[model samples]
Target: MRAAWAIYKRELVGTFCSPLAYAVMVSFLLFNGVVFYFFMDLVASNPSLSGTRGPLQLFFGSTILSVLTLMIFCPATTMRAFAEEWRSRTAETLLTAPVTDLQVVLAKFMGSMTLYAALWVPTLLYALVVRRYGAVDWGALSAAYAGVMLVGGAFVSIGLLASSLAASQVTAFVTSFGVIGGAMFALGLGRYVFTEESQLRFFSYVNLWEHMEHFAVGMMDSRQVVYYGSVVVLALSLTVRALAARREA
Candidate 1:
């Protein structure tokens, strides 16, 4: 536990100290700001279109742009975790230390998730801005944020697994981007392609689009909680195994 905590702190500090982290943070904020501006303008011009949905609800996961942003940026956020360590020969030293593979994987994962969460803190101001215009649904906003974090945790775990398997950050990013993007697209299409009731039900249960829409409206489904938790656990387990295999090799 002490080793994991120490490694986690080291990873957090090292990541924050890097120029690339700041670069990504600024780029993410800039992109989200532009999207929020357009969203606000659209809502202001067509108030009726907003209907029952709050500004934050429509802003969180109702648009293709938001989905695309996550597809691109989540991979970017985690690409350097294990891949950078390996590329710089730091992984060798780290792996030789008095730490279990699970601890190492968990430490890196927590560090990456912390950074990912920090990226979203500034976006909360959007909620404050929305509050000035009208009544904000605090419950729905909280649910939307929870959905974002759950989705982010799954994406981070996938990216971490990719990083563990790759020797360089570029490979890690590309692999994770493809997996996350492809899964989102494929699962989304399942709702339309599957005709049977059971099949459609299954697809809808796993669909990220449906999950986000529900979360945006403050409908917290237990199935979604389970699905995202499963993904994180599965991905982290694979990462630990990958690390052990590399150590043995």
Candidate 2:
């Protein structure tokens, strides 16, 4: 446990020491600001957006923007989680250390999740502003944020797994993006090909959109929470297995 924490601290500090983390933070904030402004303007023109005192409209707007930004940023953030260490031969030292492969993988996963959480802080200003000047439902807003974090964690786990499979940073980045992009678009493609009710229901069950919509509407569905948690566990398990196989090889 101590060894894992040491590795976790090392990776967390290393991430901030580079310009990449700063660039991702700045770019994410800028994208959020632009998207929020556009949504606010649209709401101004369409009174329907103002009907609900709840933050669902604003939450949905921000949620979509956040997911898109995360899709682009998370791959870059996780690209070097394992690939860079392997490239520089440092992975050999770590693999041979007095720590299990699962511990190492968990440390890297937590470090990346920490970075993603840090990036989400600045966006809280949007919620504050809406609360002060506009009608907002705090319960729904908080629930939506929770859902976003869980979904982001799941995506980061997937990225970490991709990083383990890659031989280079570029390969890791590309693979991560491909995996995330495929997952995001899979339901739509499945719908196009499978017209039957049973097949469509199965595809919908596998879709993030289907699950996220429930949370975005302020419903705390246990099934959705379990679905996201399952993804996180599956990805992390694969990552640990990959690391063990690499050590053997």
Clashes of 2: 0
lDDT scores in order: 0.88, 0.78
Q: Which lDDT tens digits does candidate 1 get at residues 27-120?
A: 9999999999988888899889678876677778677776777777888889999999888989889989989999999999999989999899
Error in Å for residue 232 of model 2: 1.2
Clashing residue pairs in candidate 2, if any?
Answer: none
Lowest summed lDDT across 10 adjacent residues in model 1 is found at: 61-70
lDDT of 2 by residue, 1-249 (tens): 999999999999889998878988898778778887877667767777677533444545335554566677778778889998889999989988999988999999899988888887877787777767677776777677787787778888989998998999889988988888777546434865788999897776666654555555676677667877898999999999998787778
In model 2, which regions exceed 4 Å deviation? 53-66, 188-195
What lDDT score is found at residue 194 in candidate 2? 88
Candidate 1 ranges beyond 4 A from true positions: none
Count: clashes, candidate 1: 0
